[model samples]
Target: MNPNDLVQFLKKDPKDFTKDDIIRFCEENKIEMVNFRYVAADGRLKTLNFVLSSKEYLDTILSDGERVDGSSLFPFIEAGSSDLYVIPRYSTAFMDPFAEVPTLDILCSFYDNTGKPLASSPEYILRQAAIAFKRETGMDYKCLGELEYYVISDVDEIYPGVDQKGYHESAPYCKFAEMRTQALLMVARAGGKIKYGHSEVGCFTKDGKYYEQHEIEFLPCDPILAVEQLIIAKWVLRMLGSQYGVEVSFAPKITVGKAGSGMHFHMLAEKNGRNVMVKDGKLSDTAKKMIAGILDIGDAITAFGNPIPTSYLRLVPHQEAPTYICWGDRNRSVVVRVPLGWTGSTDMAIEANFGLKRRVEKASKQTFEYRVADGAADVYETVASLIIGAMHGLSMPNALEMADKLYASGNIFDKEYASFLKKLRQLPTSCSESADVLLKNRKLFEKDGIFPPGVIDAQAKKLKAFKDAGLSDKLLGNEKEFAKLVQKYIHIG
Candidate 1:
């Protein structure tokens, strides 16, 4: 579809459009219905054949929704109350570019029979967190995530290459540029507003002899929109790759030794249309406290940021990934860095400052960037935790003291910082440990019933079982394994 077609489609009242409209559109466009499926929170999918000619069938499936055995899903409904429904949100509709017959896609949300939001639903947690933050702190947080993922040549096997070609190495070195361009197009077609896409120098490898490179790029969108983009991007990449016989992994670490992918979240708190993170051309006290809150709750939050066992592989020391709980100006070694703004010059005006700079920079203006999260995480959960913690900090004046202590403590692994780390409470190490921490700290996340007791227990049991079954062992070892072991019990997401 061209820009005009998209504009015409957008002009139509989506609510009035029936199944017939969709079928007619698909038929007119030579789109295939089989290319689409209803994805549920439980990770199960139901196929929708194109043969259905009735508009009511589409209405029932899209609006009336469908029931699923929630007990089978991850940490949602238990066996005793296993009934749940998935309602497709029309706003999320898009065309699958890789389908043999172009297929329409829609993202679904899980709801209880009573129409209440499911406690374990990431979307629910996110909305609750956002609402609570606004109500408590009088601050409106806006986030744009810079998602960095790799596009590998094959998916069936793990191929590790050490290439050091910094950002935008171009052509032969960046073999996946064409694929990324196609992916970006799909993202645009899906209504995701992207700032830019280019090679991430952070994940490059160059041995002076062998030149193999991996491409990394950023896609910018509002917090909710970004999560939606991620979901659709994953699907698009998978579908596109299948067509090209190539595969990609958003896994934090695809191989044993390599730069891990990170979903660096750029967040700013706004009030009455002004960025709250800035004050007098510098980072605001509230922003500092927010940063502190993240560090204070860093360990626990890691559970959501780095949810998978393999995620630990990318968070080790000296790997450009954060291993310590500290923040500094433009220092990637720390968990959070307030990048330096253009100093002593108007050309380097702070207006250009965005992303991490918006939250942490004060003199030059800054923003807070939660650096620990990875692609495997439920984006909603990760963002929710950060928003909640930041809001809590904003409400409490003492949070500044906490932030100072965290900043002064330096690296958590260092002996000198151990005292501060101990006082702040350690983060969970293993997935099971993280789940246990969540169970123990349920009150922190349970506000407004965002995390119910039953849901928490279910997650804990699942994580424990996963650990016992050796999933962590198979995915992580060495520095990553040891780090997880140490922080296995810290409560996070």
Candidate 2:
């Protein structure tokens, strides 16, 4: 389909499109709806197919709402109070390319039986945070992410021999380039505006004989689009891998000793169409304060950012993982990096030259890159925490004072920097500690009742179980064979 035609179709009001129009669009596009399962119930997703046959039925369901038993969802509602509604946002509907019957994918917001938004709904939490930030800072926050993952063949799980190539190694060594190309096309078809896709630098091999396996990274324009692309890309990769008898894993650290996957988020703040982080070609005070705020709240946010127990296996010191809490310009060792050549003018910037004059025009268009998150996290919650934290920093009484205090103190994880970090009252190292932090800071997320007490308690219980099992010690032992062992298990599993 032509981009212009797609745009026109999207512009049409939902009421204007008939059931036939949707069906015809799917037929023309050769879309196939494959597997669909309810997130909150056991019913097959095929039920939606019948409902879509009648516009009236669809509208009634859309208006009256789609009900589901939320008890089955991870860490949400309990079985006793499981009734939840799925209110699909019309704007989020997109054709699922892999669907055999030309299916559509829509993001759902969970609500109680009474029609009130559920506090545990990750989407609701994110929206609440966004609204709060706008109210406080008068800025519109935009986030983009570079998501990286690997594609390999003849693998049940990720293993040492699965991928045997260096970064950007193509052709014989990176045989999965074709798969990535197809996946990129699927992402495009799903309405995700991709900035670019390419092979990244992290690759390794178990068997010395075959060195063609590789990983690919995609950069998406906005946070929402990035997350949608992440989900769609996963589906496409799985389907493509099955065709070739291969597999793909988005595990933060799929294989031990190799470079782990990270969902690196880049954030920018704007107001009234002007970038708030840039002033006179340099990082504005607001930008620095936002970075400082991230540094301040990173530990607590890690519960959502690095959600899984295996995630810590990748955050070891000096492995390009963010074990320390610090931010620096062009410093990969730190948690946040003010990407190189971010000068206010695109011409003067490292990537491109968009000439714009402002106070920070000579300074740089400051963007903060958070390297902490992994694939398993709920993107909505993680992004919400960042927005709220940044806003908190911006509105702090002594923003500059806090920024300088953090910068001068250096890595928060370091022994010397521990004192300063203590002064700031940061989060702890283990999952249990993180849970405690979350419990102590529940007020932060409860401002609008966006995060339910039950949800938090449930997650804390899971974290506690892992902690009690000493799983972290077993999985992260010594950090030397950690990567290799993980790869072996994941590959074999």
Candidate 3:
């Protein structure tokens, strides 16, 4: 069922939405548990469980959401003051096909003691930006994230299959063929629209041994719903991986010297049901502004989009994870790509319960993809921050003209592109540099107070401290430093 069904079930408050109808729906699906899922500031998904069989218990908990000790959360929550409330949105409800207990899961947002929405909360921050985007532009934005990851069995840890190249390899050659099918099923059941998934061109290496790498991609949809699907998809993969005797890794660079995974975002804008990004059979002025916005603060936003040190590892040249600031049409090597729609391709509409496919518009209109981030980035923060940057750039005079000059200057993949973009502008080189960029462009985050100054300060301080501590060089010692770093922050939602 769609979220509208659950929303219609609640006659009282919208968020207090689990009612008899929802109970009946749960019973029909044999759901034994209801899970409330939220992300900490570091983007890790945390869960709070409640029994779904009893309506009274559901009412009690929904009326007064369970309190969380915020001290244990990521940097967004202050250390000394530690009380926050999590309230799940019924609109986020979905059935998990991989859950052993047959659970119902809903993504949640945070609230303060006085019941006000927590501005620092990533979900809340994204929600505020989305609302502002709709109000200011009189247009809606839809985005889909194509997330990539690696898989290996715990029993056979650190084995990076032979030759270290495995992009688009099918069964007999690919061990993940069966597992990928199951992953797509679970993703569809959990309300994800899967465009496609395949093995990526990456090899694993550890202790002087070589192995394999893989990637699964999805079509673009609503930003918030798309992010929620990302969280669920990762959960499904991990849970099922355990059952299948494999471990999943979403780290930017799982192997030290191979191709790194990137979480690319394909975005489009529309107003009155017509795409506003396209005008006169070309990218419109508004589209240029959006691209300008992305390129303008691309490095500053990397403080959130590519949050970790290893994240920078993946941003190097020729790995498919972009390093330079320039954007190119159909160029995967660049930071941003204006993709040409594939010929003879049909627009697909994947159903929530199965792979229900349909045809929609033709693939003539171009879609924008930001390839800087990986699975490690916080969905809410990255999208929200990007939106903030887009709006900020939209306010600039001759923004479209500026964007034209920025990307049309030189071939970004050339030897001189680094200096070329630097002469124009380029992405920050490190966490310290990224933080410095953010501090200089602080107004983008502070507009409308959607992202509180405290949150920006906290992120900046943490990045600065990470730099000062030399953690990039000192996170862990020995050949296992890569694995250690991945394990520390790779599970982020």
Candidate that scores best on lDDT: 3
lDDT of 1 by residue, 1-493 (tens): 4322333564654445555565566556655452234444422334444434555565556557677777765545469989887766665566766556566766667788899767567677677777787788787877766666665443221333325434665655556668778878777777666667776654433222222233323343346666666666666666776777665556676444556677787677777766767676666797898888777667777656766565665676666778667776666766776655443345433557643244543343346677888776767777888887786667666888776766642344557755655654444445666676666666776666655566556656656665633444554556666435424421111
Relative to the true structure, candidate 3 reaches a TM of 0.85
TM-score of each: 0.78, 0.80, 0.85
The candidate scoring highest on TM-score is 3
Writing each residue's lDDT as its tens digit, candidate 3 over 1-493 gives 4333344444333335554555666766667888888887666678898877576776666556778988788665667787998887765676656567878777778888889888788888888888888888887877888878777543233333455568787666666778888888777755677877887776554564334566667766667877877877787788877887766878776655677777888887778766777775777788778888888888888888877777776776666667767777778866778887543343344545367655554544567888887887878888987787667667788787768776743457677765665665656656787788889988878888778898888878877775633444553345477677666765554
1-493 in candidate 2: lDDT tens per residue? 4232333565554435444454455455554441222222111122233325444554465455577767766445569888877766554456666555656665556788788987666666677777777788888887776667666444323333333345665544555678777877776665555666667656554443222323434442344545555555666667777877766766677655667777778887887856777676667898888887777778877767766666666676656777666676666667777775446434434335455444543423457788787665557677887887787788777877777765632444557865655555433456677677777776766666556677667656666665623445665546556555455434210
Q: Return whichever of 2 and 3 wins on lDDT.
A: 3
Better of 1 and 3 by TM-score: 3
lDDT of each: 0.62, 0.61, 0.72
Question: Any runs in candidate 1 off by more than 4 Å, and if so which?
Answer: 1-8, 12-52, 79-81, 154-162, 201-222, 340-345, 348-366, 408-428, 468-493
Whole-model lDDT, model 1: 0.62
lDDT of 3: 0.72
lDDT value, residue 222 of candidate 1: 47
